[model samples]
Target: MEALTGCTRDELIGAPFKNYFTDPERAETSIKLVLSEKKVTNYELTARARDGRETVVSYNATTFYDRDRRLQGVFAAARDVTESKRVEEEIRTLNAELTSANKELEAFSYSVSHDLRAPLRSIDGFSQAFLDDFGSTVPEEGRENLERVRRATQRMGQLIDDMLLLSRVTRREMHMQETDISALAADVTGELALDNPQRDVQLTIEPGMAATGDPQLLRIVLVNLLGNAWKFTSRRQHAHVSMGTVRDPEHGPAFFVRDDGVGFDAKYKEKLFVAFQRLHAQEEFPGTGIGLATIQRVIRRHGGDVWAEGEVDRGATFYFTIPDLHVSCPVKGKQP
Candidate 1:
């Protein structure tokens, strides 16, 4: 009691235990329960020190008896838990604040999706209508300006949609299960091929690659990565894209998507996963620059990390690792 409560041994030797507690009522109730039950574990109270400082403590007590089995007194041990209690309270406060912040973010995303898009839609709609209704009356330069306005509104609409998707990915509840990543990659590739039937591209996906995660969110990851590969490889004469898994010594099982495309400079890799950060000009490679950011958030939510490696005009490979997956075997050679 002296060491735990900062009281002198002589002061605590004959003092009532309840008298040392900050809340005597709670201490009395706990003592009664211990007496009735014969033992009590982890009964918590605030103990006041001799200098008037208070500390949280947990007590374990049991009734002591002699050969006749009649109750004699209580034997107890106290552990100071003030630091642990403080840490727990801090964690609870941080969690509450984070939840409140997420709610506000969701509300803002909702406004962007609905309130902002309505006027953008009207702008684009009227621009198109004006072009259709008075194309001959307007000068060619004026018609081109209207077309530019329509395109800007369309791009803004895409940005809003992507922002909403990013917000949803962050807050959506995950449903974890075994997912066939190879099949998902193949499906996304097939869709890409259908969208650009004239383009010549070769896509290779390693079979039997699987992991444990939310299938929907994981599919979005694959779509964004594979879509990026497909988009960047558009100018390649012999485009080659591959999706596979590898074993990382530090991060466990990792997945990758490689592309022989117009790869970016490695020096700018740090900006790849940041929202609205673009390394390429829109005319060179069109994107809203939110895909990689969204992919990173989804992977992080699944207890994973995403990274990329590339050289200017050489090629690029994106890698991501998912935790808690039972990797069957490691890839034999170096990663692409």
Candidate 2:
């Protein structure tokens, strides 16, 4: 009691216990409960120190009996829980603040998607109308300038759409279950092949590669990754793309998408996952630079991480791990 209350043991030996309580009425109620129940486990109260500082304590108490079995007094032991209570309060405050911030962000994203895109549509529409109605009457240079303006507005519309998708990926709630990753990858690749049948790309997907995650979000991950691989390998005479899983000693099962295409420099790897950050020129490869960032958010929400390895002009391999899915062996062929 002396160590907890900042009072000397000699001064507290016969002092009234009620005098040390911050709330005398509450302390009296707790005493009554202990007396009636014959014992109290972890009853909480605030005790005032000699210097007027208050400390929260959890007390375990029981009635002390004399030799004749008559109740004499209460015997109790208290453990200080002031620090733990403070930590719990801090956590609650942080959670509330985070929720409020996410709501505000969602509202802002909605405004950008609808309000801003309306004017952009008007700009692109009028530019197209000018070219269609007065294209022959206008000079060649003037007509090309109108075409440039239309293209710029179209690109701006694309940027806005991608930004909304990135925001949705961050705020959306996930539904976790078993997902067929191999089939998803194959579907995305098939779509790419159908869109550009002229390109001859050899895609090898390890069959039956499975994991536990949000099936929808994981599909988005495969689309972006495989889409990038398809786009970058467009110039290759024979493009080679593969999707499979590997066992890592430290990270457990890791999935990868590898492509033999135009790869980026290792020095710029850190910027690969940042929104609006592009390592390659727009003229070389067209992208709004939001795909990898969206993939990173989805993987992180599932308690996983995504990374890449590549050398200039060689190829790139993207690897991600879902820690929640304890997948050990390969679904088909031997591990790579």
Model 2 clash pairs?
A: none
Candidate 2 least-lDDT 10 residues: 326-335
**Which residue pairs collide, candidate 1?**
none
Query: How far is each candidate from the true structure, as Cα RMSD in Å?
Result: 3.1, 3.3
In angstroms, the error of model 2 at 23 is 4.1
The digit string of per-residue lDDT tens for model 1 on 71-111 reads 99999888889999999999999999999998898888888
Choose the strongest candidate by lDDT. 1
TM-score quality measure for candidate 2: 0.84
TM-scores across all candidates? Answer: 0.86, 0.84
Taking the tens digit of each residue's C-alpha lDDT, what string does model 2 give over 273-323?
999999888888999999999999999999999999899889899989987
> lDDT scores for all predictions?
0.89, 0.88
Residue 8, model 2: Cα distance from true site in angstroms: 8.6
